[model samples]
Target: MRTPLPGVAAACGLAAMLLLGACTATGRQASDGAAVAPSPADEAAQQSTVDTKWGPLGPADRDLIVRVRQAALWEIPVGRQAQRRAARTTTRRNLGEIARRHAGSDALARQAAVKLNVPLPDQPTPEQQSWLSEITGKSGNDYDRTAIARMRTADGLLYASIGAVRGSTRNTLVRAFAEKCEPAVRARLKLLEGTGFVTGDTLPDPPQVASAPLPGNPKQPASPAPAATALLAGR
Candidate 1:
C-alpha cells in the first residue's frame, strides 16, 4: 500500500483554490453555478500550449519588481527583523504568483503609468506618444493584458495594476499594491487620474505622492513606494 502525501496534496489543493480566487470577478460568476471554463493561467499551469510562448523579463524590469517588493515590506508594520523577512518573503511570493497567474504586475503598472501621467514632465508631445506606444505595444504578453507592468523613467519606474491581494497570497495584484503602497502611492498618484495610462505622458515631477516619509518607513523616500507598488497604487 502506498502512503498518502497529505502535505503535498494539501499544497496542491490550496494552489488551485488560490488560482481560482485570482479571478474573483470571474470566479464569482462561476460560483453562481454557471459552469464556466478554466482560465489561461490554469490551462498553462496544467497543460502546455505551443501557441503561448512566455517572454523573458529584462533586468531593468526585474529591478523594478524588487524595488516595489521592498517598499511593500517596509510599509507593513513589524516588530522584528524576522517579521520584516516574513513580510518581504510574502511580498515576493505574492508578486511572483501574481506575475505568473493573473499577469498582475503589468496590469498595475499600465494603470499607474496612465493615472500617474508617466510621460516626462518636460517634453509633452511626440516623445510621450512614442513611449506610450512602446509600453502599450499591442499584446506583448498573455499577462500584459492583466499583469502589473512598471515603466522606467529618469526619476524612477512607474507601476500599475487593477487590484491587490492578502497575505498567504494576493488574490489580486491590485489590492496588494493599494494596501502596501498606501498614502504615498495615493500622493504620488498623478493628476492624470483620467488620462489613458498606457498612452498619456508625464509632465515633470509627475505629481510626487509626498515630500515626507514612506508609509511605515518614515526615513524612507519622500514618495518611496516601489516602482511596481507605485504602478499598483497609480490606478
Candidate 2:
C-alpha cells in the first residue's frame, strides 16, 4: 500500500488508543462488580426481626413484657407502704396480698425477659415514681386511699392491655404470660375495689355500645349500670 498520510496515521493511532481504553474500563468494571458479602452492620439491619419457635416477636409483645415488669416495680412498693399504713384490717390484708402477687408477677416477668431476650427496665417510670412519692407522703387512711386509687387506675389500664395482648398475641410465650397476668390483674382489681376506695372516676370507661336502635324496637331500655360501675359509684 502507498505510504499513509501523516494526518491519517495520527487519526488511526488515536482510534486504537480510544478502543483500548474503552476495553480496559469495561474489564475493570466487570471485575469490580463480582458479588461481595454484606458487612456486619448491613447484616444486622437486614435481620431486624427476632424469630422464635413460638412465633415472631413483635413490638407489642415486647411492650407487654416490659410493662408487666414495670408495673410490679412501682406497685410492689406502694402495696408494701399500704400494708404498713392502712387503718382498716381488711385493707391491710388486701395490700399484703397485692404485694405478694406483684412479687410473683415480677419474678415471672424477669424470667420471661431472659427467655425472650427482651431488655427490661431496672426501675419504674418517672410517672410511676411520682405516684409512689405521692403515696409515700401520706399515712393511715390518706395513704390507703391514695395507694388504692392509683394502683386501681394503673392496674385497670394494665388489665385491659393484658387482655388485649392475651387475645391477639401470636407468640405462645407472650400469650401465656398475658393469660397469667389477666386473671391476676382482675383479682387485684377486685381486691382494690373491695377496699372501698375505687371511685367511678378512677375506673376506665366501659366499651361503647352502638346507639342505633334495632329495626323492631324504636327505643331500647336504658341498660342497667354495670355492677362494678354501680358499686364504684356508691363509694
Candidate 3:
C-alpha cells in the first residue's frame, strides 16, 4: 500500500535540487536558471586552439604532421625494399618515386614540427613495423604482392585522413602540409594501383573520396627553394 511516500519523495527532490545547484554554481545555467550543457563549438572555443604563429594548431593538425613523419619513417624503408625486390618494373619505379617524395615530405614534417613545437616519433608505429617485418620476410612475387597490398591499403587510409585534416584544419602550416601531402599520397595510391596488385581485397572498402584535383605535370621538376634547401641541409 502506498506507504506514506511523502518523506521519500521529499528526499529525492532535495537531491535533485543539490545537483542543479552544483551545475549552476559552475556557471552552467541558462538565463532561466535551468542547467544546460555546453555546445561542441563552445567547448572547443574554450580550449586553446591557437598554439602557434602559423595559426590555430588543433589536435588533428598535430596528428597530420606526426603522421607524415611516421609514414616516411616506415614507407621509405618498405619502398626501397620493394624497389629492389618487386618483380614488376613499374612497381620498382613507382616505389622508388614514392621513397624519394617521402624524403622531402619527411623534411617538411620536421620543419613543421619544429615550428609547432610538436615532438615526432623516431620510429614507425608497431603495426607499421609489423607490416615491414612481414614484407621483409618475403621475396620475389610474394614480396611484391605483400608490399603492394599493404602499401595500397595504408595509402588509401592515409588519403582519407589527409582529406579530413585538410578540410577541417585551421592552422596555415597544417593546411599547406595537407595540400602537399594529399597530392603525394593520392599519387602513391595511384602508383600502387597501377602495378595491378591492388584488387578489391587491397582497396579500402567503402571507397574513400577522390575529388582532389591532380597537380600539374611539370616537364622538369623545379629546384628546391633556397630556404627549403637550407632546411633540408640542416636535417
Identify the leading candidate in terms of TM-score.
2
Tens digits of per-residue lDDT, candidate 3, 10-95, equal 32332233223211111133444344576776555433356677787875676667768878988999889778888889889988
Alpha-carbon lDDT of model 3: 0.70
Candidate 3: where are CA atoms >4 Å away?
1-50, 207-235
lDDT of 1 by residue, 1-235 (tens): 2232222233233333433433221211133324345577754433321221122222222223333443333222111222223223433333333223222433454453343332211112232333334434433232221112222121122232211222322223334344544333433233112212322232222323338753565566466447886678957
Q: Ten-residue segment with the worst summed lDDT in candidate 1?
A: 146-155
Q: Write the per-residue lDDT of candidate 2 for residues 86-114, one digit (tens) a residue.
A: 88887898988998898778887888888
Candidates sorted by lDDT, best first: 3, 2, 1
Sorting all predicted structures by TM-score, with the top scorer first, yields 2, 3, 1
Best by lDDT: 3
lDDT of each: 0.30, 0.69, 0.70
Q: Give candidate 1 regions above 4 Å deviation.
A: 1-162, 167-178, 194-235
